[model samples]
Target: MAISLHWLIALLIFAGWGLGFYMHDLPLSPAKLRYYSWHKWMGVTTFILAFLRAGWLATHPAPRLPRVIPPWQTRTARITHFVLYLLMFLIPLSGWLMSSAKGVPTVYFGVLPLPDLIGKDKALGDFLVQVHKWLAFGLAALVGLHIAAAMKHHFMDRDGLMGRMVPFLKSPRL
Candidate 1:
C-alpha cells in the first residue's frame, strides 16, 4: 500500500510538472484552459495521496537502516525523506494557493469546487507562482537524490535496500 501510494504520487507529480511546463508556454486558448484544469486535478489528487501516505507511514513505520549502513548515511536518508514528504504536501498546496489568489476556482474533476484559501489578490498569486515553481524544482532535485541513493544501495552497497519497496528485489542479502 505504501509503495503503491509513493509511486502513484510520484507519477502524478512528474506528469503535472511536464504538463505545467508545456502548458505554461501556450497562449490563452481552450487547450490551455483544459490543460490547466488537468494540472489542477493532478495537484489535488497528489495532495490527498500525500495525506494517506503520511498517515500510513505514521501508523506503520518504515524499515530500519541496516547496521552495515553508516549512521551519518542513515541520518541523511531520514532527513531527505522528511523533506520529501514535506514537499509532497507543500507543492500542491502552493498551487492551490496560487489558483485561489489568482481568482481561479480549483474544481476537482470539474465537479467539486474547492473553496479559496485566501481572497483573490493578483500580487499574492504572482508571488505564489514563484513559490510553487521553486518548490517543484526543489522536489525534483530531491527525487533525483533519492534515486541516486537507492541505486547506490542496490548496486554499490548491494544492500537490497530498495527491495522494501520493490517486491522483485526482495532482500535475501539483508
Candidate 2:
C-alpha cells in the first residue's frame, strides 16, 4: 500500500512539475488554461495522497534500519524522511494558497470546488508563488537524493533496504 502510494505521488509530482514549467511560458490560450487546470488538479491529488501516505506511515512504522548502516547515516535518513514529508505537504499547500490569494478557485478535476485560503491579494499571491516554486525545487532535490540512496542500498550495499519498498526485486548479495 505504501509503495503504491509512493509511486503514485511521485508520478504526480514529476508530471505536475513538468506541466507547471511548461505552462508558465506559454501565452494565454486554451492550451495553457487546460494545462494549468490539470496541474492544479494534480497538485490537489498529490496533497490528498501525501496525507494518506503519512497517516499510513504513522500507523505502520518504518522497518528498522539495517545494522550495517552507520549511526550518522541512519540519523541523516531519518531527517531526510521527515523533511520529505514536510515538503510533500507544504508544496501543494503553497500552490493552493497562491492560487487562492490570486482569486483563483481550485476545482479538483474540474468537478469539486475548493474554498479559497485567502481573498485576492496580489502581493501575498506573488510571495506564495515564489514559496511554491522553491518548495518544488527542494522536493525535486530531496527526491533525487532519496532515489540515489535507495539505489546505493540496492546495488552497492546490498542490504535489502530498497527491497523493503520494492518487494519484487531480489536483494543482491554483497
Q: Rate the local accuracy (lDDT) of all candidates.
A: 0.94, 0.92
lDDT (10s digit) by residue, model 1, range 1-174: 899998999899899999999999899999999999999999999999999999999999988888999999999999999999999889999999999999999999999999999999999999999999999999999999999999888877888788887878854453
Model 1, residue 96: distance off in Å is 0.6
Worst 10 residues of 1 by lDDT: 165-174
TM-score of each: 0.96, 0.96
Q: What is the lDDT of residue 147 in candidate 1?
A: 95
List ranges where model 1 is wrong by over 4 Å. Answer: 170-174
What lDDT is reached at residue 109 by model 2?
89
lDDT of 2 by residue, 1-174 (tens): 899999999999999999999999999999998998999999989989999999999999877997899999999899999999899889999999999999988988889999998899999999999999999999999999999999998999888889888889988874
Question: How many clashes show up per model?
Answer: 0, 0
